[model samples]
Target: MAKKKQTLFECQHCGEQSVKWLGKCPSCGGWDSFIELNQAEQESLKYLSKQTSSDKQKAMPITKIEEDDVVRFSSNNTEFDLVMGGGIVPGSLTLIGGSPGVGKSTLLLKIAGNLAKSGKKVLYVSGEESAGQIKLRATRLDANEENLYLLPEISLEAIQNEMLRENYEAVIIDSIQTMYSDKLTSAPGSVTQVREITFELMRKAKESRIAMFIIGHITKDGSIAGPRVLEHMVDTVLYFEGEQSKEIRMLRGFKNRFGSTSEIGIFEMTANGLESAKNISNRFFSSSKEQSGSCLTVTAEGSRALILEVQALVSHSTNPNPKRSATGFDTNRLNMLLALLEKKLDLPLNSYDVFINISGGIKIKESSCDLAVIASIISSFRNRPISRESVLIGEVSLTGEIKDVFSMETRLREAISCGIKKAIISTKPKGIVGIKCFEVDEVSKMLELF
Candidate 1:
């Protein structure tokens, strides 16, 4: 008698398997995430586990390993090279993810073209778009180079074959989710297929010393789609973040084995392609006359300081409980600020609707912007405008005391370089040649600005 075929339902969100269909994934708590897939036998799964031994052999003494053989190449994109901690390391797997149409492909294509121009044999592979389509885009971006090659294929075996035939220095897989292998019976984007494909590419990249760039699709929650295992297997993980409708985009390094994760690359999207955003500080500040509900602040993106505009709108709430909303800022922190305003600052915020926004689509993760947020909210509540020339820089504590922020001089210098005149800081700052500085010891003193 023939052996019975087995089937299992797997959660695409978390890669959990179940004998029966589940309405929601027990592992990841995602609704209706289970997908029925035919199980290939254990013998067939061996291909995914097979490893090559070109680079890693028996463990040797740490000092014996050769360091001069390691190679790094610049893609010729200044901001891209900076965020990547100098340049792309050879034989490394980098996964770049973003929402649909956030310039992930465009940025890679531009890099591929640049690498090709530098006499590095490069192959541009696209599983989603055809060669003709990519050619059209290359022409539009003016990235058509003599050495740049294109391979619009999806099968992993075919891609490897092409790589072996051409011996290219760099290769770009337009997306990892679209690649499939004959070893796995699941769908192309299923957890098994994504994991297997990533493993194959990673091993091949290590063996051949090829700089590999894998474009990944992001889920609705802004995480790279497919199994989280994909992120762990890669050497570097980058995310392109910004509003789709906006002109600016931020390339952030989420995980970097060779560099600092705090580094950020800013880009401006134009009709030609993505260019380095050099004067981004001016972009965040509006040109219109200063008004209430808006305040200026300086933030640090890694080592670089950026001048930002913090805006808030406070009004009487129609509902029983006032609504609190924040964009590009943490909602919980905003709520804490509101409570602090009520208790410590004696502001009646219980019956008001608070809306806060960090202008220019730049998300503020640093706590140094806390005082500036409070100042903007209070400015809106009191209907008084803050001097555009003045910038608030400090952290606000729950006890309502102002706290000093790191790199105070860097933040203020960025503000002064942008032609700002005054700074509202917690501790007294020194060497402020062009700008005037004022020290505010408590949250209550911030109210005296208006």
Candidate 2:
């Protein structure tokens, strides 16, 4: 007698597994995201997991592993190479994700062209665009190299066949969502198919010891569209974030196995191609005279400190419940700051509508920006501007006390390099030569600013 196959349901949003179908996932609260997976897939997953576990268990002494050096290859782009942790490691799978027209494709093409021109064999595979479409963009970017081979096929078998045909140094699969497997009945970008396809590519990359750069599509929620495991499977994950209307793009490493994550690469999109951004520290602020409701602060993006303009708008709320909104800044942090202002500073802020935004689409999460945020709000409420050439750097306590932050001196120096003269800090340091650092202990003392 044949055994009955068992099936399981997996949530598409959070990859939660369940024995039975659920209207809403108990783990992630996602509605109708569960997909059916037969017993075959479950067994396959177990087999793969066992194989991986066995390899890890066979690990030798740590000193023996450190004796060997990893093979690293540079794509010849400084900014790209820096974000990639010195260079790309062979047998590594990297996923680069970004919104449409944010230059994910462009950046990969440029890297491919550069590698091929430097006598390295590269295969550029595109499932979404034809050879002609890639060629047009390459021509515009002046990226015509003899060793840069282009394949506009989507079949996994065809791609695998090409991999077997030659020992290519690097392979790029543009937009992994467009590739499909014949064994899967679901669509190409479906959760099951994505998992299967990534597994195959990862296995192939490891066996061949070839570096693979796979482009991934982003969901409406700004996360990489696919199973959550897709990110975990890859060796490195990079996010290219920027405004579509603006030319400045920033590439940051969310996960890197080779090097530190405290590195960020900045790029500017020009008509030709993406170029390394110059003077990134000062480019985020406007040039005109300083205005009310806008304050300057320095926040660290990886190791680099940038001068950002924190803008706030406070107006009388017509509704009984005031509206609060924040962009590029945490809304919860804004609310907390507002409550502190009302309780400790004696400001009736709950009755007004407040909005806060960081310039240049740069998200500010450092607690050190708290002083700048509060100052911006107060400036807007009083219709007064602070000192023009000063930058605020401190963490605001819940009791409205100003607290010192890490790397306060580093932030102040960056501001000085951008021609800023004054830095209002929480605690006085040993002091630097160029910028004037003023230490303030409470938020009330800041109300006397011009």
Candidate 3:
């Protein structure tokens, strides 16, 4: 009698493995996401487990280990380099994900062209698009160069063979989801196939000392569509953010071993392609005629400070439970601010509908914009317009007191550069020459400014 084959099931959502089929995954709480692995996939899993567990290397003292001399080269795009923590490092595996038609392909193609122009051998591989299709795009992007080669292939084995044959310095995989491996029986984009292919590419990249950039498709929830381990396997991870209808796109770094992860790269979509925004400081706010329900605030994005507009609308509601909506701002935080206003200022906002919006499609991630949100709400509720020359910078506390925020000096400097004449902050800073500062300690005190 033949020996019975061991059964193995894996969760498609989070890559949790089990010896039997499960209706619901305990790891990610996903329903009906577990699928039994094929014989080949089972063997692959066993091999990987043994390899990882049987590591022969021993731990050494930190000071005894020799440091590695990291090598980096610019992609010739300032915005791209900024998000990448200076530049591209050889043997680095970078994964970029974004929504469809968000310029992932366009941006990478342009960077490939830049590398080629700088006399570096570059290869562009696509599993979805044909060579002719990429060529059409290259023409629009002016990426035609002798060193830039296009390969319209999807097989991982074929790509590896091509890389082995050529002495290319950089490679671009149009998408990782479309690539399949012959070693695995699973279909392309499946958990097993994606994990195996990423592992192989990572090993090959390190061995050949080649820089690799792979594009990933995002899910409906705005996360990269693959096993969570896919992100852990790469050296860097970047996400492209913005609506296709908007001209401005922000590239944010989530994981970067080479540099700071807080840095953001701003790009403008144009006829030529995605280019660094020239006037980034003045892009998020308007200095036009002052209007009610609108206020200016300064927020820090890594090393750069930007002046952003916070808009709010308040109106009487007939329903007992009024509607509370926020765009580009946290809805939960908005509720907290509303409750704070009602308690501290004795405002009758419980029967009103409140709406908050951060202008220019920019999202506010810091609490420093809390004061601006409150100012905008009050201005709209009272039918009063705040001056555009003034900016609100502070964090609101639950105790109805205003608190100072980080990088206050940098934020005020940016406000001054945008022609801001006055600032309302939690605490006034000394030696801020361009803008006059006023301190408001309590929420009730902030209302006096209007």
TM-score, one value per model = 0.94, 0.94, 0.97
Model 3 local distance difference test score: 0.91
True-structure lDDT of candidate 2 = 0.86
lDDT of 3 at 278: 76
Query: For this target, which candidate reaches the highest TM-score against the unseen true structure?
Result: 3
lDDT of 1 by residue, 1-450 (tens): 998766677788877878889998888899999887665623344444454334456888989988746567898988999888889999999999999999998999999989988998999989999889999889878889988999888899999899889888899999988988886777788787888888888988888999999999999888999888789889999999989889999999999988898989999999888989997899999746889999999999888999999999999997888999999999999999899888877898999999999999888888999999999999999999998899999898888899999888888888878889999898876666888888887887777788
**Model 2, residue 98: what's the lDDT?**
96
Which is the better candidate, 1 or 3, if ranked by TM-score? 3
Model 2 per-residue lDDT tens digits across residues 1-450: 998777788887767888899999887688999988766566656755775675546758887775537878888888888888889898999999999989998999999999989888899999989999999999988789999999998878899999999888899999889998776666778777777878889999989888899999898888898888899999999999999898899898989988777778899999889988978866789747878899999998666788999999999888899999999999998999999988877889988999999998887767888999999999999999876689998998888899998877678778889889888987767868798888889888877654
- lDDT of candidate 1 vs native? 0.88
Worst 10 residues of 2 by lDDT: 50-59
Report per-prediction Cα RMSD to one decimal: 2.4, 2.0, 1.5
**What tens digits encode model 3's per-residue C-alpha lDDT throughout 1-450?**
999988899998779989989999998888999988989998877776675575788989999999978879999998899999999999999999999999999999999999999999999999989999999998989999999999999999999999988999999998999999898887898899888888888888888899999999998888898899889889999999997888999999989889998889999999988989976868777798899999999999888888899999999999999999999999999999999999999999999999999988988888899999999999999989999999999999999899999889999988887889999998887788988898899998867888
Let me know the TM-score candidate 2 reaches against the reference structure.
0.94
Rank the models by lDDT, top first.
3, 1, 2
